[model samples]
Target chain A: MPVKSLKKYVGVPRDVVANFHGKQVVYVSWDQHLLFAAPLMLCLPPQTTFRELVDGPLAALIAPDPDAAAVDWSTVQWLKANQPWVPDFDRSLADNGIVHKDQLRLSTPGLNSLRPAA
Target chain B: MDMKTEKKTLNLKERYRLLTRDLGWEPSYRSADEVFPYVKYEGIKVHDWGKWEDPFRLTMDAYWKYQAEKERKFYAIVDAHAQNNGHLNITDARYLSALKLFLQAISPGEYAAGKGFARVGREFPGVGTQVACQMQALDEIRHAQTQIHALSNYNKYYDGFHAFADARDRIWYTSVARSFFDDAMSAGPFEFMIAIGFSFEYVLTNLLFVPFMSGAAYNGDMATVTFGFSAQSDEARHMTLGLECIKFMLEQDPDNLPIVQGWIDKWFWRGFRVLGLVSTMMDYMLPKRVMSWREAWEIYGVENGGALFRDLARYGVRPPKGWDDAEKAIDHMSHQIMLGLYQWSFGTSFHSWIPSDDDMEWLAKKYPTTFDKYYRPRWNHIKKLAAAGTPFKNFGLAKLCQCCQLPVVFTEPDDPTLLCNRETVYEGEKYHFCSDGCQQVFENEPEKYVQAWLPMPQLFQMFDGDVAAWMDWVSLRDGHDNGDYDGSRDQQNFQQWRGLATSNQ
Candidate 1:
């Protein structure tokens, strides 16, 4: 059954892109790493280039993992909306079609802390 | 058979009738529909509200007498505990971390349950359900009070216990539980019954109460154990009420089968997520372990809950949609949640630490297949970090599931190596979920969930992205109430006091 209420329950979404005060809220996760505990919620400029995110905030976030730096950036498969999508390093997040609350999953091959190679 | 003499000789059934059903009057000024406006519109067809049964048959006077007796006994123990220095009687200062978590998260939930029950009592057209709800509301408040009084014994000598009242409203982690109650509170009355009564109280209450109470007993916490004993009686009535509500709803009309099924599905998942905290408490928080979280889930969740669902099958109800996933999760969630809590301990009301060598051994033995392979290395890494003087702290806010309000810390059911990252685009805005269960809850009712007052958005947009302002608003004192437990005041002081109690040193 639909929600039974006196008034139509129309609510303004709390995390709309416009609510972020000019910063785009992008969630980045290293797919196999449980060490990070959760996908980091980052506030960055929508106009910020994909390369800048990977090299700047993303670098510092993953720097704690020893094997993270060794994984070649180009080989790191990116998942958006649960499907793989290659990002142009030169393109801005907005230009690359990443929106607010988008969980960009980084499935780094060979950097598996959960199932380490014997 | 004089009337005056007959009144004093009233039986249980007679006393119940006089106090409950006899008290409600037929309103001449307003129709019953107007008086009980919320009884409908959720599409539950109750042919007779009178079908709702109160098996306990307890009268208000009897309830008061019983509760007063329990209260007298409960507080006497609490006062004695304080006078005799019962805080020093605990296993260790680390044990207080579990107590601090209980106060900050679970106690306020009891208070919320009281308010929810009272509202439903008024809305249910039947006097039987109304009386049951009324008694439950009182039970909930009493529980909240006794729990506070029990844990307050620690507040005098503990760091994390100081700011729990304010922390319930404003803290990030407390929202895991706080939002669970808020979700139930915002729903209609019948939904409230299924959410709290059947699912939380009947289905999952053991996973919550038993482990903690036993952990309290094992840890030599007499006050908490007494509080547990006091509340266990009330829990029986609650479980009965929940079962009755489910049976009443289903047996009322065939149309209610699907509706009740949906609610069972929703609440069971919701209750499971909230109990992740308890699972962590059982596994990681208690200094003296009662049982592993996985074992408790097998006993309480899988066995007990499985039997309950089997009985519910006659009503066409299956186990929760999240059951299989939860079975997988029980092995992993405590480790994941503790990892998150430890990393974010700086933001919490309780201190978290790297486990002792004994604790790790216990974890390994308890979770043989998963622990050493998946979790031990991460703990080892943190141990190394602490050794090097930089204890691993995640200084950034974690993205939370919009529905459960928990940090998206859980992994995929099929693949524990990969994060169970699920999302949906509704009305041009994106919403994220940690699992299929939470995602389905949102998809079923996007209108209700979009209004979620998520903490990250509140922190960034409302608090101007200042962690200090956020902490100030939540009343968490930096470096005192939170962070690593090894060298903290709670650790040092407990060792000092307990030593003094033991010897001249």
Candidate 2:
């Protein structure tokens, strides 16, 4: 039998998010529409890439099935068919002193580093 | 008399009980140092290891059986969930960013500790720490594996999960965790307990694990939270071990009082600095956030830790050396760090704008000190952008502490605006970090954290050359974030599971 589309307000309860056992997920809102996916939790604009969104924390949470057959990329022709928008780094990070990877960042020395001058 | 001595044998259980309780012998040595040399140099003295009590009365068989049972229960849950395509909400797999960070930055550190303890156990054979170390070694391995297994279930559904374990071997920021653990493992057994167990687990873990699991639960993820809490129970045991070890050291000798107090002082501050990330996450990460870092600090740090220390003071143990500094920083650090992360979080982890008016109202009530005074103006801008139908763009590079990896948001000792900034020049180049604790770390052994190969550099390196090859490599390694739970094997299984469930209903 074919899987039906999740019904509006009536299908699955929103709190079912807590019931999930294996994967980490977040609800991202695009205007009024809500999209559910695993890994990234941000409410991204329509253009973020699959690559940029998958971070280290999210990557470590995914468990693989022991008996699943090997994956074939040829089946994923749909991703190539649809061009998704990639996310750009936001500007506010700098105000907090966070440097982009391309930029040179400075850290303050620790207190332990300060000795009664040698 | 001969007839009475004739045939009596104790059973295995009785023998273990008697042996563990009775095996200890009083030292017949030139000095206590000849028997336990390592305990003295670190400035910690233990008058009695015998005074330490294991609350569970966990003899060896009970330990093995209970531990095995726990593993069995956890794996059973893992299997059932996996069989059902238990990954929930399409967004569920995307949140792997947190797991990625844990595996790469924190998981290997746990394993490293196991190795470290194995060595420490050998060095300090008589101290009860060897047993504690053994338990921790096993617990750390369990933590690493359980974390990997829980997350591995999502590998089929997500990207980036695979690269993280490898990333631990390479990342610079990761060195913060690695170096912190190495420092503990290399220190005397007493300091190791203070640093990793007492300071890290007891005082700081609630800040890290509670918020993290709550975030997982709030985000509609169950498996991650389960694993996190499961590992955390073991953390609680470790905490007990730590407290016991410290008290034992302090009571062991008259001279150990000052020494043990100093170790407590040093390790507490060291572990506290590392919790900056946790502070940010607790305060900012979850959509449905829990107790603010301010409240958490007040309750756990001030109330619990402060009170605990007060009780210990009755025994001549003083509060940790830098307790005041920690208290002063707690009021502001999490907010400053979160404000920074909110700006740069785009394309990393799950990015979201700063708090809404409702959220700010909650924060103001929770953190009356700095929220209104310093943080409100900043949130107003973010709020304005959200209202204007513009999600705030990424913020700039927040200065990370070279040692602790926290952003340089610490206020100058007593002042907030004048950033509590410090730096050191090792071998002619300047290295900056946030606090005296971290600075001491870098200065003590500049060679360690300096050797770290940051992940951002590696990612950029991959991106700069061989575009197709890099994309392909990173996609397999990082897990592509393509929208739509459309075509992965996990998604397909999810569909099948959904189909079956609904049909049954």
Interface RMSD (Å), each candidate? 1.8, 23.5
lDDT of 2 by residue, B80-197 (tens): 7688766654243324445556666677877876776666665563534555666777888888788788778776655546566544554334556776786677566666767777
Per TM-score, the best of the predicted structures is: 1
CAPRI class of candidate 1: medium
Residue-level lDDT of model 1, residues B1-505, one tens digit each, is 6555434578879888878766577889999889999889777899987888899999888899999999999999999999999999999888888888899999999999999999999999888999999999999999999999899889888898888889998888889899899999988999999999999999989989999999999999999999999999999999999999999999999999988999999999999999999988999989899999988888998789889989989989888888889988878999999999999898898989999899999999999988888899889988988898877888768999999999999998977777888888888998989899999998888888898888877888877679888888899898899899989998899999999999996
Give the residue spans of candidate 2 off by over 4 A.
A1-118, B1-15, B18-57, B89-100, B214-219, B346-358, B379-399, B425-429, B440-505
TM-score for candidate 2, please give it: 0.65
Measured against the native two-chain assembly using Cα atoms, what DockQ does each of the candidate structures obtain, in the order listed? 0.64, 0.01
- Which TM-score value belongs to model 1? 0.97
Per-residue error at B459 for model 1, in Å?
Answer: 1.5
Off by over 4 Å in 1: B1-7
Return the lDDT, model 1, position B131: 91
Q: What's the lDDT of the predicted structure labeled candidate 1?
A: 0.89
Report the interface RMSD that candidate 2 achieves against the true structure, in angstroms: 23.5
